[model samples]
Target: MDFKVFTIIATIVNFLILLAFLKHFLFEKVSNAIDERSNNIKNTIDKTNSDREEAKNLKIQVEENLANSKLQGKNIVEDYKGRAEKLFQDIKKEASNEAELIMERAKKDVEREKEKAEEELKKKVVDLAVILSSKALEKDINEKEHRRLIEDFITKVGM
Candidate 1:
């Protein structure tokens, strides 16, 4: 094993020069590319996070709008129900008033009819009394004859 010191020194110097050349040209460009790629990946991740947050906010807004629509629908239904109930009550009251008016008219008609019948009855009684008086004057006012006249007058009045 012959150790040559000058040759070893020359090889070390050559290795150092090759390392410096690679670091200045190839290594510098490769490092720049790696840094650019890392920055692009970080920007993409940030954009994705922002998009996800925006989607979540939009979903919340949609849910709130849907809830509001449902509440409005319920309110509309209740309002219509109230209107219908009021209309029904008004109609019922009007019908009751009409019925009362009809009953009053019927009562008045019945009263008028009863009064007319009573007037007719009084006139008939007066005519019968006059006939009895004339017959009594033509005959005598005896008890048996008077009783017979009353019986005939009663039978005629009944018929």
Candidate 2:
């Protein structure tokens, strides 16, 4: 091989010019493309993290709502039970009052019947006494007239 110093110098100058051209055009575009890709990846990662945080917050809210719902359900059930108990007491009191009214009415009925029976017995006794008196006196008068005379005499003495 034949070595040429001038040719070597020319080749070195050509290589430096090619490196400068690549740096200005191809290398700059490649670096810009790489930076754009890195930015896109970072944005995607930030969005993913935000979505994950939102999901976690939603889960926590759901759990809290479920707990509140259970508490409200228990309160509702307790309220119903209290109302039922009050209703039961009111019904029992009403029944008791009704029973008392019935007993009082029954007692009044019994008293009325007793008084009626006593009135009937007094009338019968009066009738028997008037007949006996008429028979003992040997009066030929009707029993009714004799009883009327006795009644008039008693009334005059009493007044």
Best of the candidates, TM-score = 2
Candidate 1 Cα outliers beyond 4 Å, as residue runs:
1-36, 126-159
Query: Which is the leading candidate under lDDT?
Result: 2
Where does candidate 2 stray beyond 4 Å? 140-159
lDDT of 1: 0.84
Worst 10 residues of 2 by lDDT: 150-159
Q: What is the C-alpha lDDT of each candidate?
A: 0.84, 0.88
Per-candidate TM-score against the hidden true structure: 0.58, 0.79
Q: Residue by residue across 38-150, what tens digits does model 1's lDDT show?
A: 99999999999999999999999999999999999999999999999999999999999999999999999999998888767755664566567657577545645655666
lDDT of 2 by residue, 2-121 (tens): 999999999999999999999999999999999999999999999999999999999999999999999999999999999999999999999999999999999999999998997676
lDDT of 2 at 124: 66
Estimate the lDDT of model 2. 0.88
